[model samples]
Target: MTVELCAQKAAAAGATYFGVEYYGECYWGNSINSASTQQNANLCTSYCAGNNRQACGGLTGQLGLYVNPSNVVPKEVGSYKTWVTQGCYSDSADARSLPNTYNVPSGTATTVEICLDAAAGFKYAAVEYGKECYYGNYLSPSASKQDSGCNMQCAGSPSELCGGGNRINLYQNNAYSQPASEKPSVGSFSSIGCYSDSGSARALTAGSSTSDSMTVEQCVKLAGSHKYAAVEYAK
Candidate 1:
C-alpha cells in the first residue's frame, strides 16, 4: 500500500525516476544526474511490502531510482542465458540453410557467449563440435535427435557446455523476435543476411577482435557503416 501510494505520488509529481526508502518514504527525482554517483546494487537493501522478492529502494539519502527502458538504453553488460538443449543436427543437411554461420578457429577458445554474440541477429543459436556456432530463424522438427546428444564443454568456458560431435547446444534467443506465428520455432538478434568475418564484420580488426569485448553500440555502428540491415556478432 505504501509503495504504490509513493509511486503514484512520484508519478503525479512528474518524476522520471522514483524510489521507495526505509519501507515507508518515497523519493522522486528528475534524472540520475551523474553516472559515477550511482550506488551499487548491494546498497539498495529495503524490500517492498507488496512483493518481498523485489527491492523497494535504498536507505535514507540513497534513493532507489528505477530507470525505465523507454527513457534509457541499459548498457549491454556482457551476459548470456543458458537455455534448454536441442538434439544433434547439421546446419547444412539436417537443419535448413542457416541464416548465418561462423566457425570459431580451432586453436582459439570459444564460449557460448562469444558464439551468441557473433550470431547477433538470428532467432535460434546452436554451438556444435565445440568450435562451431550457427544462427538461424528456426529449428526443423525432423532434425532434432535427443537432448543427451548435445553434451560437450564450451571451448572458452569449460564450466559451460557447448555441444557434442554432430550435436548442437541449441538455444532460443529471448531478445530476438519475428512474426507471432513464425516466431514460435525461431528466436533472437541483428540483420537477416549480413555477413562478415570476425575481424571484418563488426570491424573488430586490430584492437577489437573478441566478440565478448564488443558492446551493443559498437556492433550497431559497425553494421551501420556496412549499410547492412544488421550486424550479427560472431564471424
Candidate 2:
C-alpha cells in the first residue's frame, strides 16, 4: 500500500507510529524502540504498491517510518457532559469493579469517549489497563477507592491516564434509566435468572439470535419457536 493510505489507517485506529515495509506491507505501533533506528533514505528504493513513484522500503530491514499527524493526546478523559469521574478504584482478574459489561478489541486503541459511548445506558463506566472498557450498574462490594494507583496512560490518548494493572478509572453516568423488566413467559418457558456471559466464553452457546429492539419477551418467544430450552438477552 501507499504511505498515505497506511498512515490514514493507522491514524483512524488511534496509532501514533506507522511504517511501510517490503513495498506494500504496513506496520503500526504506539512506541518506537532502539532497534528501529532511522536508516538512509536512499535505501528505501522499492516502489509503493499504490503509487509507483514513491519508495516504500528497501529489500533489507530498512523501514520507511512515519508519525501520524492527526494523533492528538488529550489532557484528561475523566468527565463528559452527563458523566463524572468516580475516582480510581481497585480491580482484579477474578473480580472486576464494574462487571456488568466490557469491550476489549485487540489491536484497537481505546479512548475515554469510546468507553463512555459503549456504556451509554449503564450507570457506571470504567477504563482499565489502558485498553479495556467495562460497564455496570453497581460497583463490586470488594472493590474500594484508593488514594493513588492509576498510573497507566490510555492507549489512544497517551496524555490521558486510563488505569494501571488491576486498577480502574471509573465514571458515573447521571442520565441512566433502568430498563423495564417483567416476568417473561413464552409457551411455558418462564424466567430463570440473570447470568454473566463473556465474548470468549458464552453461557448459552447454541442457536443464538439477535434483534435491534431486543426484549426479554422477544428473546423467549424466539427461543420457544425454535424449540430451544433456554434464552439469554444481552444489550
Candidate 3:
C-alpha cells in the first residue's frame, strides 16, 4: 500500500503513529518508543505497492515511520452503564482476584471498555498491569481491598487508569445476572469430596483439558475416555 493509504488507516483507528514495513505491511501504534529507532533513508529502497515512485520500506531491517497529522486523540474509558468501580484489590500470579479469564482474545493494548466487553457475562471485571483484562463471577477469598495503588495508565487509553503491578482496579456490573450452577452426573462416577488444589503443583498432571462451559459430567467422561481413574474440575 502507499504511505498515504497507511497513514489514513492509522489515523482512522486513532493511532498517533504509523509505519510501513516489508513493502505493503502497515503497522499502527499509539506511541513511538525506544524499540523503534531511526535508520538511514537510503536503506528504505522497496517501492510502494500502490505507488511505485514512493518508497515503502526495505526488505531488510528498515521501516518508514510517519506521524499522523490528524492527531485524533483516542477515546478514554468513562462511566459505563450499570458499572461502578469496586475499588483497588490485591492480585497475584498464584492467586488472582479475578481468576476466570486472564485477558481478552485480542490481548494487546487494553482499555476499560475492552475488559468490560470480554467480561460481559461475569459479575466482576478487572484490569491489571496496564494491559491485562480479567473476568470472574466472584472475587477470590484470598484477595483483599487496598486503600491505594491502582495508578497505572491504560495501554490503549493513556487518560484512563488500568491497575498497578500486583493490584487490580475492579469493577462490578450491577446488571449482571448469575447463571444457575450445573449439577452433572456421568455413568457411575460421582464427586467424592471437596479438595484443595495448587496451581504450582497440580493434583493430576498426566493429561488435562479445559473447557469454558465445563461440567463435572464432561470432566468425568473425558477422564474415562482417557482411562483415567480420577477427574479434577476447576472453576
Candidate 4:
C-alpha cells in the first residue's frame, strides 16, 4: 500500500520512480525518482522470479498503461491485485472490461499482472516484457529452483541454453547427452538401388566392416539403420 501510494504520487509529480527490495531484508526506497523509469521498473519488479516465468508456461504480456480497472479505488491501482489494476475504478466489471482479453493465462496469481496503455490517464495495452518473452514458456513468479521455472533461460543444447557465455556441448542439456562419436556401418553390398537385407548373410556383420548384419527376427533393429545393404561412399 505504501509503495503504490508512493508510485502514484511520484508519477503525478512528473518524476520517474522505482521500488526495489534489496538484500532480502533492506528496502532502500519504496519509490525512487529517476530519469530511467522503465529500467528501474524492470530491475525492481522484473527480476529472475518474473523473467523465468516466460520459459515455464509462455506468458507474453506487455506493460499496460491504464486500460483495465478493479473495484472501488481513488483512480489509482491498489495492492494485492495491483499489477493488473489500471487507473481508479469502481467495480470488477470495469477491471475485467479490457478492450480484449489481455494475452495471459487465466488464473489467480496470473490475474495480478497485466499490461495496458491508454492515450489518456488510464488505458490498456500489451507491451512486450522482453525481446524473448514470446520465445519462452510462461514461467511462475517464484521460479528460483531448478525443477520449476528456469533460472536464466532453459538449458538447451548448451550453446542455446541461458547465460550463453560458453557451452558444455551441443547435446548435454537438461541432464542429457550422447556418445562421444559414432562410426558408420559397412557391408560389401550394393553401391546403389533402394536396398534391404536380401543376401543370406545379409552382406555384413555388426562388427565386420565388410560383412552385412542380419536381423535374426529376435533382434529388431531400427527401421532405418541400414538399407540392409552395404555400399561405397554413397550417401
Candidate 5:
C-alpha cells in the first residue's frame, strides 16, 4: 500500500509516532517540529503540482506519510514536539483551549488535554500536528512551505484547526499532563466557549454583567452560551 494509505490506517489504529517522507528520505515527526516537516510537505506539493500529480510517487519529491507505532493522546502535554501530529497551547491567566477533538470540549467529549503549568510573563506557545499549527498569539495565518527533513505542512487558515474560544495564547515552559477540568483558574472569557452553568447565569446577570468575578471554568461555560455577550478577563 502507498504511504498515504498506510498513514490513514495507522491513524485509524491509533498510532502516535510516525515518520515523514520527503525526497526519498524519511524524517521522524516526533523528534522534529512541524516547521521542518512543513517545508518537506511544501516541496512535495510543488513537486506534485509540477508533475500534474495529486499524490506523491514516481517523483524525486512529493512527501509520503510515515507510519509509526504510538498511542495517540487526546491532547499534547509538556511539548509540541515534531513527533506530535497535533495539539494546542497558550499563555494567559486564562485556560488554553484545544479543539473539541483535543481539549476544548464540544457537543461531546472527542478530545484530550495537556494543561501546562502557569508561569510569569510567558508570551508564546504553539500547538501543532503534522504541518498544521494552533499556537497561542497565533492570530492570522498565511500559507507557506516549511524546511526540509520534516513532513509538516500548513494551508494558512488559523481557524481551520487552530482556533476556538476567542483565540487562546499558549505560554512558554508551561506543562500540564492532566485534563482541563483540573484547572479552574484559567480566567479567560472565550467568545466561542462552553457556558452551561447556572440556569440563571445564562442571561445577563444584570445591566453590568461581566466574567471578571467568575472562575475560569465558570467563565468558559458562560462563554459557551448565547445569553452572555462575552467574558472580560482582567489584565
Candidate 6:
C-alpha cells in the first residue's frame, strides 16, 4: 500500500512507529520494538510512489521509520497572530481547500493545539475550516489579512476560532511578544504579564490586594476603583 495508507493504518492500530521499506513496503510498531533498528533519516531516500516530492522508505534492507508526534506536547512558540484571509499562501486551490489532505497527507488534526503539534517539523503552522492544518517553511507577506474574516469556530473547540474559506490562521514557534523598553502613555495600556498599566507614572495607589485566583478583568476593574492607571497582580 501507499505510504499515506500505511501511516493511517499504523495510527489506527495504536502504533507509535511507522516505517517504509523498498519504496512500496510499510512497517508499523511501537517505540520499544523499533529502537534497535532506528537509523539516520538520510538513509531513507526512496521516493514515494504517491508523491515524488516526499521520501517514503529506504533502499534494500533499510527501513524508514518515523515517530508519531500526536501525543507529544508542542512547545509554546510564543504568541499567535493572523496570517491570511480571503486568500491563500499558494496559487493552488487544492492547497487552500485541503491543507491537511492535499499533496501528501500530513495527518488528521482537529484543533489548534493538535495542528501546532503536527506542524512541529515546519517553521509555520496554519489552520483552515477548523479541521484542517497545514505546514510551511515560509509565508508570503502579500497574503496578510485581518483577523475578522477568519472567524470560523474550530471543530474540536467551539470557543476558539479557526480560519474560514480562503483564510488561514498562521502561527510560528518563534513568534514572541516583545516587551516595550519604555512604559505606555495616555490613551494606551501596557500588558505586563497578567496586569495592564494605564501608562501613569504615579505610584500604584496605596492599597493593592494579592489574590491567587484573580483574572485580568477583575484586576483591571479593581484598579479602576482607586483611580489608578495601573493594575498589577503578583503571584
lDDT of 1 by residue, 1-235 (tens): 3567777886787666666766556777665453424455566678877667667766655556553324332221124663333435544444443456787754346667777777776677777766678787866655555546555656444445667676666766666777533112111334344345563354334233237666545555554444332323432
The alpha-carbon lDDT assigned to residue 49 of candidate 4 equals 33
Per-model CA lDDT versus the true structure? 0.57, 0.76, 0.75, 0.24, 0.33, 0.56
Q: lDDT, candidate 1, residue 133?
A: 80
Q: Best-fitting candidate, measured by lDDT? A: 2
Minimum summed lDDT over a 10-residue window in model 1 is located at 180-189
Q: Residue pairs in steric clash, candidate 3?
A: none
Model 4, 1-235: lDDT tens digits are: 2344434654565443223232111122222233422221232332223333221111232121111111111112232221232222111222321233334333211111223221112222222211111111122232221221111222111111121111100110121233333223323322244345444655455522322444322122332355453342221
Give Cα distance to truth, residue 106, candidate 1, Å: 8.0
What ranges in model 4 sit over 4 Å off?
22-235
Order of the predicted models by lDDT, top scorer first = 2, 3, 1, 6, 5, 4
The stretch of ten residues in a row with the least summed lDDT in candidate 2 is 226-235
- Can you give the TM-score per candidate against the true fold? 0.37, 0.49, 0.47, 0.18, 0.26, 0.32
lDDT of 6 at 202: 33
Candidate 5's error at 108, in angstroms? 29
Could you tell me the C-alpha RMSD of candidate 5 in Å? 17.5
What's the true lDDT of residue 180 in model 5? 32
- Candidate 3: residue 157 Cα off by (Å): 1.2
lDDT of 6 at 86: 28
lDDT of 2 by residue, 1-235 (tens): 8999998888788888888888878988777673654455678889898899988887789777776534534344658868999888899989878776556455346777778888888899988888888998988998899877787777765656787788888899999987767566656776666667786997666667776787667676666555444444443
Better of 3 and 4 by lDDT: 3
Error of 4 at 149 (Å): 30
Best-to-worst ranking by TM-score: 2, 3, 1, 6, 5, 4
124-220, model 3: which lDDT tens digit per residue? 9888888888888888998899987787877665656788889988889989997755444457764455566687987677767777786667677
